[model samples]
Target: MTTTLIIGGSSGIGLATARLLVARGDEVHIAGRSAQRLDDARLALGDAGTDVATHVVDALDAAAVASLAAKRAPVGRLVLTLSGSEGAGRLAELDLAALRRAFDGKFWAHLTVLHAALPHLAENASITLLGAITARASMPGTAGLAAVNAAVEALVAPLAAELAPVRVNGVSPGYVDTPWWGMVPDADRRAFFDGVASELPTRRIATADDVAEVVALVATNPNLTGTVIEADGGARLKAA
Candidate 1:
C-alpha cells in the first residue's frame, strides 16, 4: 500500500482526498490546524481501518511542520492543499492584511511543507499542490486569490523539475462544493454557485469527488509532473 502524507486534510478537497485514499487501501497520514477536526476525521475514516493517522499541524508554522514530518517514515505521496481566504473588495480597495493573510496561509505555507518534508519524500514520490480556477479566470474581489494561486502554479513548475525522480504537480479545481464555500454569506453562496455553474460547459459546479479523483491521479502518476490538471468541468472553456 502506498504511504501518503496529506497536509490540510481536515476538510474540503483535502478531507475528500484522504477518504478516497484510505478507501483504496493506501496508508494515509493527515494533518491540519484543528485537533477536533482531525479527531472527527479519524473517527469518520475509521471504517477505512488503521491505515489512517491524523496529526495536528499548522502548515504556516515551519517548526511544527518540520516536527510532523520527522514523525513519519518516508512518504510516497505528499499532497498539500492548505487553504486561506482574503479580500472581498475591489483591487483599488483591497485590504492589505487580507492579501498578506491569504498569501501567507496558502502560498507560503505550501512552501513550508515542501521545505520541511523534502528530505523525507521517498524517491519517485509525487507531490501535489492545490490551486484555484480563479487563478486562471479572474473575477472581481479575487485579485489576491489570483495572484497567490498563480504563484503556486509557478512555484510548482521549477520544484517539479528540481525534484525530478520525485514528481511534483498541481490540481487547479473550479467551483468544488466544499466548506470553503462556507466563507461566503449563505444568501450569496447559492446564487454565486448557480451563476458559476451556469457559465461552465458542464452546467454544474464540481464536486469534491471530482477534484479528489484528479488529485489521486496526480499522486500516482510518476510520469506526470509540473502539470496543472484543471478539473473545473470545462469552466476554462466556458470562460473564453
Candidate 2:
C-alpha cells in the first residue's frame, strides 16, 4: 500500500485529507502535537478499511519532528496542515514574542520536517504544504500572518527544484471554518465568516474538505511542481 504521512493531521484539513486518502486506499500516518488529539483522530478513522496510524510529534519541536520523520518509512506523499496563532491585529501594537511564535509554528517547522523526512521520501513522492490566502491577499489584522504565509509559499520554487522528482507544492486556502477560529467569540466568528461569504465570488468560505481535495490533487498530479495552488474560492479576485 502507498504510505502517506500527514503532519498536523489530528484535526482540520489534515484529518479530512487522511480520511479521504484512506478511503481511496493508502497507508495513512498522521502526526499531532497532543497525544489525546492523535488518539481522537485515530478513533475517528476507526473501522476504515485502510490502515491509519497516529504519532505525537509537536511540529514546534525539532527533535520530535526529526524522530518522527526518522521512524516513518519512505512516504509516497506528505501533507502538512499545521496551525498556529498568527497574532492577528494591528501590527504597531503587536507582541513581538507572539509574532515570533507564529512564524516558528509554520514555516520553520515545515523546513524541519521536510529536511528530516527527505531521507525517507520515495521516488516521485509528492509534498503539499498547507499555505494560506494571506500569502497573496491583503486582509485587515493579518499583516504578520501575510508575511509569514508569503514566506511559506516562497519555499515552493526552491524546494521543488531541490527535491526534483519529488514534487513540492503548496495549497493556499482562504478563510476556512476550522478550529483556528476557536478564539473568536461565537457571534463574532459567525459575523466574520458571514462577511467573507457575502463578498467572495463563490459566495462561501473554503472548508477543510475543499482544501483537502486540492491537496489530494497536488499529491497525485505528476505534472505539477514548484507551484502554489490557490484554493480560496476566488477571494483573491476581490480587493482589500
Candidate 3:
C-alpha cells in the first residue's frame, strides 16, 4: 500500500483530500495543529477500515515537524495544504503581523515540512503544494496572500529540479466551496460566489474534490514535475 502524509489534513481541501486517499486504499497519515480537529477528521473518515494515523503538529514549528517526520517511514507522497492568513487590507494599511503570520504558516511551514520529510520521501515520490489563483491574478486587499503564493510557485521550480527523481508540483486552485466562505457575511458571500461562478468559463467554482483529483493525478504521474496544474475553472482568464 502507498503511504502518504497529508500536512494540515483537518479541514477544507486537506480533509477532503484525505477522504479521497483513504477511499482509494492509501495508508494516510494526517497532521494538524488541533487534536480535536484531527479526532473529528478521523471520525468523519468513518472507520475506512484502512490504515490511517493522525498526528498533532503545528507546521510552523520546524522542530515539531522534524520530530513527526522522524517517527514516520518513507512515504510515497507528501501533500502540504497549510492555510494562510486571509487578511483584508490595503498594502499600506495591512497589519505586518498578520502578513508575517500568513507567510509563516503557508510559505515557511511548507519549507519546514520539505526539510524534515526529505529523508523520509522515497525515490520517485511526489511533493504537492497548494497555491491560489490570486498569485497570478492579483486583487486588492489580498496583496499579502498573492505575494506569498507567487513566491511559493517560484520556489517549486527550483525545488523540483533539485529533487530530481522525486516529482515536485503544485495545485493552484481558484475559489472553492469551502468553509472559507464563512468568513464573510452570508449575503455578501452568496453574491460573491454568484459573480465568481458566472465569470468562470466553467460557470462554477471548484470543489474540494476537484482540486484533490488534480493532486492525485500529479502524485501518480511519474514524468510530471515543476508543474502547476491550475484547477481554477478558467477563473484566471476570466479575471484577466
- Model 3 clash tally? 0
What TM-score does candidate 2 get on C-alpha atoms?
A: 0.94
lDDT of 2 at 157: 93
What is the TM-score of candidate 1? Answer: 0.94
TM-score of each: 0.94, 0.94, 0.93
Candidate 2: pairs in clash? none
Please say which candidate is ahead in lDDT: 1 or 3.
1
RMSD of each: 1.6, 1.6, 1.6
lDDT of 1 by residue, 96-198 (tens): 8988888898899998899988888788889999988778875667777888888888877898889888899999987888888887788899899898788
Give residue 128's lDDT in candidate 1 (0 to 100): 97
Of the candidates numbered 2 and 3, which has the greater TM-score value? 2
**Better structure of 1 and 2 per lDDT:** 2
Ranking according to TM-score, highest score first: 2, 1, 3
Which RMSD does model 2 reach against the true structure?
1.6
Error of 3 at 55 (Å): 0.8
Residues 89-200 of candidate 2: C-alpha lDDT, one tens digit per residue? 7788887788788889988888788887878888889999988898888777788888888888898999999889999999999879888888899999999899979999
Residue 4, model 3, lDDT: 85
